[model samples]
Target: MSWSIRIGSIAGIRLQLHVTFLFFLAWIALSQGLLTGHAERAL
Candidate 1:
């Protein structure tokens, strides 16, 4: 296999994983903040 093909595949996989991580981080931050606020209100 050509080096270009191998590099391209690696780059594509890295980009995909970077995007997935950003999505999950945003979701977790939002959800945890909301839960903390609710818990504080209940106290």
Candidate 2:
């Protein structure tokens, strides 16, 4: 569907956002921040 599929250009390229991927990225970032002792940065 057009609502879910993107058909456009981002500097001559297309782009899409995946909610699951974003959550995983945030989780990884938070884990790294906590590991280095920056708890505030995690949030």
Candidate 3:
């Protein structure tokens, strides 16, 4: 399923990324880092 929508662009450049997917990725990385006792690198 397509979870991302081509929001917009500028100067002929194309931008693509699912909002939720991006957030989900961030959450995963942060959580993993925190759980691994590396909270300083969570972001």
Output the number of the lDDT-best candidate. Answer: 3
RMSD of each: 10.4, 3.9, 4.2
Most TM-score-accurate candidate: 2
Model 2 weakest lDDT span, ten residues long: 1-10
TM-score of each: 0.43, 0.56, 0.53
- TM-score, candidate 3, is 0.53
Off by over 4 Å in 2: 1-14
Q: Across residues 1-43, which tens digit of lDDT does each residue of candidate 2 receive?
A: 3334454667978876655676788899899999999978886
Q: Which is the better candidate, 1 or 2, if ranked by lDDT?
A: 2
**In what order do the candidates fall by TM-score, top score first?**
2, 3, 1
